[model samples]
Target: MELDFPKRKIIHVDMDAFYASVEQYDNPDLKGKPIAVGGGSKRGVVSAASYEARKFGVRSAMAGYIAKKNCPDLIFVRPRFDRYKEVSNQVRDIFFEYTDLVEPLSLDEAYLDVTQNKKGNPSATLIAKEIRKKILDKTGLTASAGISINKFIAKVASDYNKPNGQKTVNPEEVIPFLEALDIRKFYGVGKVTAEKMYKLGIFTGLDLKKKPLEFLDQHFGKSGSYYYHVVRGIHTSEVKPHRIPKSVGAERTFSENLSSEVFMLEKLDSIAGELERRLQKSKIAGKTITLKIKYSDFTLQTRSKTIPYFISNKELILETAKELLYQSELQDSVRLLGISLANLNTEKKKAAEKESVSVQLKIEF
Candidate 1:
């Protein structure tokens, strides 16, 4: 059956205070207490803070000392990713029942397209509710969901009524709903971008919608076009599922073969930037770096090296990618350049080591 685009239904489900909630769920004494999931060292950062902790302004990513100052009674717990991953699978199993088009945004959140669900339910609201209830019943934790015609609206709606709540914005309401939203709250528009938009007098989605595509492009480059359409309810991003990806990286095939070492280095930089974006989007990083080069004659050469620590930053990724690029003398001019990060580390330690002044990984290239 051909699914109708106009009638497409998307649901964004997010677990509530996922890590801290999991800690509370497993240990009853921690319930209703102000708790944070992360390392307790003075230099550590809070990975997740419970609702009680939020009351005192404690938040995720805040340094341990700052979080403690905000909530003196804050209790700290180390992250147990294995437990979280187990529960994540349980929640995902519920999503798969409704639609296979489930894209996990993180260990605790996902977007599901249910335009033509297995249950044959016409109401997307019902499916969101059922999924939430199943999650609670199976995992003993609460989740919030947003239902709408597209992913952007659905993702925003999910946050509106959070911590065990549900919200739905019907097709007719997408416009007014977006118009009333703060630019800072738009999906993918981070604090820095929001501040830039504020400086441009674009504080609300309504303000953003008033700017022409040309004006936005001049001000924001390629992303300007994205904002223009997203504000007008024109997002069409699909729910791409990566059930089990062997590797996560990006590659570019050139129309013209590249031979100069200087030009090859520049291309590697671009490839690294794209790779970083993918890793950030998936909330994952890896230690293994691979460089694949395809010559103009169709011959291929691949060089790879594994480092001690996981990496997901542009500078370090580019650093390693460049090393891999120079590993062996080129056999011929390159037609395509690819960079990949395998040996993925989906579970980031809650108590990460003190922030190093520089990123240094032990590797042989």
Candidate 2:
């Protein structure tokens, strides 16, 4: 039967201490202990830390040295990106078994739209629990899930009961849930932004919801309108499926601006290497190559060339980037360099079409 109204069932699933937990799962000795995953050097930052470490104020992106100081016995493990990606693929495959409306935010987090799930389950909470169970069974990992009518509240609820937990916020409970939420707990408010909101006496969602949209826009610019809606549990973003990428690219900002063409070419070579790695991983070919440059003054420019045949060879991509770089004049010091490949092939397009078809069937039937 045709559904009379639009029913959106969004679930946000986030792995607890994704990197660190993975390490612990692989090594039984590390379980139940404080652990972190990242570079161990002085310049290193924590990529992820166990909840035990978090109790001591350790967090991702914090300086490794500071993390160590906060938790002296913290075990440091190096990041294994390839392994993480493999597990991510495994998890995503599980999601696809339920619904094709899966949007991956990163290697360890995603939003799943399961309004018309394969199992014909009407309760989103049950679907979330089953997904978590399957992830644990398949990967030996713990994940927290949140279920709600929309993306914003779902994501927030996921964080509420973390590390092998799940929470659901029904439509009737949305307003009360948001009203008591701290302003900093709102997604877009970073440290500086939270401090700014605090200065304005905005401590809770209720406070933010009470503010005029025009006043917020005057104070926070374009994002002010965003905050206004979020406080009221309103979110309209759709889950974007992972498809064959339209472009493979890499960009890097320099520590210090360089005036020499030779230095700029060196940076371009590095970006080309990254793009080549991604292209090889995707097993995709492209016919068009583009080179981008940013001047010290922040002005940006790009030059592109399209070949007759698609190629995935790293040497070809690098050569094209070098040629583009040479074709452009060096008028100012270079602050950034980027290389990209576009105009992908039919294989990815076909796969994306199949996925869309499945999503449509789930939502309609």
Candidate 3:
């Protein structure tokens, strides 16, 4: 087999404790304190935790009670999404100064392809350094960067340094670096996948690399081919300047669970209206509607319907969502209901369908 990977240089930039840092920077009283951004109530979850709070093992997505238990001094602040979006725009503007091939994963992280940047700079590392500097200078917040020949290696390299630092994995160094990496650290291998790999005696990148393609394909399905090539430093996913979104979704978590289907239907209507508004506002329409239900006991179920054409109006979205909902009996008293539109008229479905050869790697750190 011939491996002719692209020689393009890529960089992954990530903000450090973005939400918490924003809170701390804007509030003088929060400086030098262990703070988290999100809910303080038991039913809520932490959106982000400051480095001070992280020292005691606090982290994002942890339940509020667990975060508080980990760090008794943890100060929880409500999320300010509007302010964060403002700063994100500033960071993205700085990135555009270097490259147009920018793919934003979220407000705090993105992948940039600087193979032929606006500045014509040859070194991706230097661009990363300058970008980080500009983010701090403009936004008064720190950012970390990883540099490499492709997104997979670049994303992993970015986390090697933390809190306003950067690391670059040269093309020559990618193989050795991946060889030394644990399988658990691979781009898409999650907890369950790692456990499955461990049971198969595939504990490291080298072990994974040694397995045959057929074996991997049989074990992991479509992602098998992706894992096979990535381990050998062969990643072809392009740095799309326009990363079409996968879905437009709206969800609500109720303070009180609803048992009656009539009441649930009302909540779904509200969610569907919000979803329609967001979709229209984004100037996007989709062919598929998904209904997500989360029960009081934390279990979840989802139903989806893909229609023939795109629709963004509230009535159509509500009708489809309601139909999907009634297809199955309510499993339990519901606490959360969400409506989302997918199968959008974009490269999203195309990218997902042909994921074997050109799969964009997502950052998980």
Top-scoring candidate (TM-score): 3
Tens digit of per-residue lDDT, candidate 3, span 1-365? 33455668899999999999999999989998999998877678899999999999998877788899989899999999999999999999999999888999999999999988899777788889999999999989999999988899998888888988998887667788998998887889998899999998999999999999999999999999999999999887889877778888999999888987788888888888898888888899999999999887778799999999999998999999889888978888988899999988753433344333322222211
Prediction-by-prediction clash tally? 0, 0, 0
**Each model's TM-score, in the order given?**
0.69, 0.71, 0.88
lDDT tens digits, residue span 248-326, model 1: 9888878578887678888888999999999999888899999899876667788899999989998998898888887
Question: Where is model 3 more than 4 Å wrong at Cα?
Answer: 329-331, 348-365
What local distance difference test score does each model get? Answer: 0.86, 0.83, 0.87
Which segments of model 1 are wrong by more than 4 Å? 1-6, 243-365
Looking at model 3, report the run of 10 residues with the lowest lDDT sum. Answer: 356-365
Tally clashes: model 2.
Answer: 0
The candidate that achieves the highest lDDT relative to the unseen native structure: 3
Between candidates 2 and 3, which one is better according to lDDT? 3
lDDT of 2 by residue, 19-51 (tens): 888899989999989998986555567999888
Poorly placed runs, candidate 2 (over 4 Å): 1-6, 243-265, 272-365
Q: Candidate 1 has what TM-score?
A: 0.69
